[model samples]
Target: MVAIDANEVSKRYGTLQAVDRVDLTVEEGETFGFLGPNGAGKSTFINMLLDFVKPSHGSVSLFGNDCQGEGVAARSRIGVLPEGYSTFDRLTGRQHVEYAIRSKAADDDPIDVLDRVGIREAADRKASGYSKGMAQRLVLGMALVGEPDLLLLDEPTTGLDPNGAAEIREILREENERGATVFFSSHILEQVEAVCDRVAILQDGELVALDTIEGLRETMGGGTKLVITLDRLEDGTLETIWAVEGVDTAVATEESTVEITCTNDAKMDVIVALHEAGLDVLNFRTEEASLEDMFVEYTGAGR
Candidate 1:
């Protein structure tokens, strides 16, 4: 089932276009990542989908119904963890979530939802006293309380530590397994690569790329980087290294180190050639190009 669909959605602010013509569809039971650099219109596009911001052109549909035409009926079936969500400072975490559920008229147990987000112990603490990460968790807990069919998370792990980030990823994975579509936006390319089934990359308010993680890697020319440590520097090393058919580029370092970048299929060939060059190679290791590098190459920025 198509949980979310945006066709030729366009949003503009005066003369500047925030979200240019774009098309996106998220299937049920999949984690679809909306990826882009800052000011790339990711949040604007998401806001249009949520009907928080109306589009200048085109339309957005949720669960086969037009999102913009409805009176919160479609919205009731979806939950959102919006970017920069703020809660009442005086209210405790538990109260915040319960209040959201009540306001939404959702039928769910707030306690169980809070526990699922690993914020049970902090539920009694005031929102003003919560850490940045904890505040994020509380809002997410509120989003889950509705048990909606789809979840829209914008930079959901921005304030989380490594462990909290991993925990949230796992929870989203479990939610996907249980048949909820997760439409998420994040500047963290590695997180998208690790958790998302498919991704759409926007640049300068335009959809520049869309595909599976592996497919995007292929499109970006997947490669492995090799860093070789030598016992001592050698003369004519650059020329000798370039002699290997598959070595794309090589840079020699002052500390007797050379770094070679090549495709995966060409790595072993380059390694063997390095061994035969009469150079005392102390050690060698291969580093693969991560999704982060691919994102930078495509989006022209990193977060």
Candidate 2:
């Protein structure tokens, strides 16, 4: 069964359009990433999927159930670590997990769940005294209570240290292995790249790009980049570099460095051209575009 399906879904508030018409679908057991800049309507779209915010137009469904018309049934199949979730300050860590267990009618032990989230030692500590990271982990533990079919995590690593973030990644892998689909949205591009099978990039309330990392690189063209530091750059140096048959783009940096995007086969040609132009090659290296790189390219957020 499809884990999520949205057709021409959109949301508007007053004169602002938060999410434009967007069509998206995720397969069962898939690890999908949703990305967008601040105020780009990512959260609005997610809230629509949860039926927390009604759409201005179009429809969305969860596991074949219309989220708007059947909100409870749709929610039953998903576990969400929502953005800006509040923990009950009067409850202890264990109490929170136990509440979720009871709410889901699951037989999971609260202590076991707390231990799995690395908060076993603080199970009796009131949430009012928990650190931000601790509170984050508590909510994640609550989400894991019943082993729901879909895990919708929004900025799951927000306050985590490196070790804590790594632990979350491991937990996600474990859940996906156990047949749960993961719909992850985060600003941490590296973490998303580490686990997601495919990613969709949103901009200005529109779906701008959707593909696997490599597929995005291919679609963007010249996935390989060459950073060449030269002794000095003369006039038309960039144009000379761009003249190379396979080069897609060439730009001269402030420090006499030339950045070029070209096919892997064109790497050597760029260097030879610099030498032929009488510019001494100081240093050069090739790197494939990272998710962060593509995110910048797609969203125009880089400066």
Q: Each model's TM-score?
A: 0.81, 0.88
Clashes of each: 0, 0
Q: Model 1: runs farther than 4 Å from truth? A: 225-287, 301-303
Q: What lDDT tens digits, residue by residue, belong to model 2 across residues 1-303?
A: 899999999999999999999999999999999999999888888899988899999999999999999999999988899988999999999999989988999999999999999999999999999999999999999999999999988889889999999999999999999999999899999999999999999999999998999998897575787889999988868878878877766766667887776778888988898889888999999988778778876786532
Alpha-carbon runs more than 4 Å astray in model 2: 230-280
Question: lDDT tens digits, residues 1-303, model 1?
Answer: 888888999999998899998998888888999988889999998888778899999998888888899737668778789986788899998898889889878777777878888888888888899888888988888877766789999999978998999999998898888788899999877788889889898998999988887786676456466788887766767677777765556767557987765567776776677667877778889887666656665664421
Most accurate candidate by TM-score = 2
- Of candidate 1, the 10-residue stretch with the lowest lDDT total is 294-303
lDDT of each: 0.81, 0.89
Provide the RMSD of all predictions against the true structure, rounded to 1 decimal.
4.5, 3.1
Q: Tell me the lDDT of model 2 at 64.
A: 92
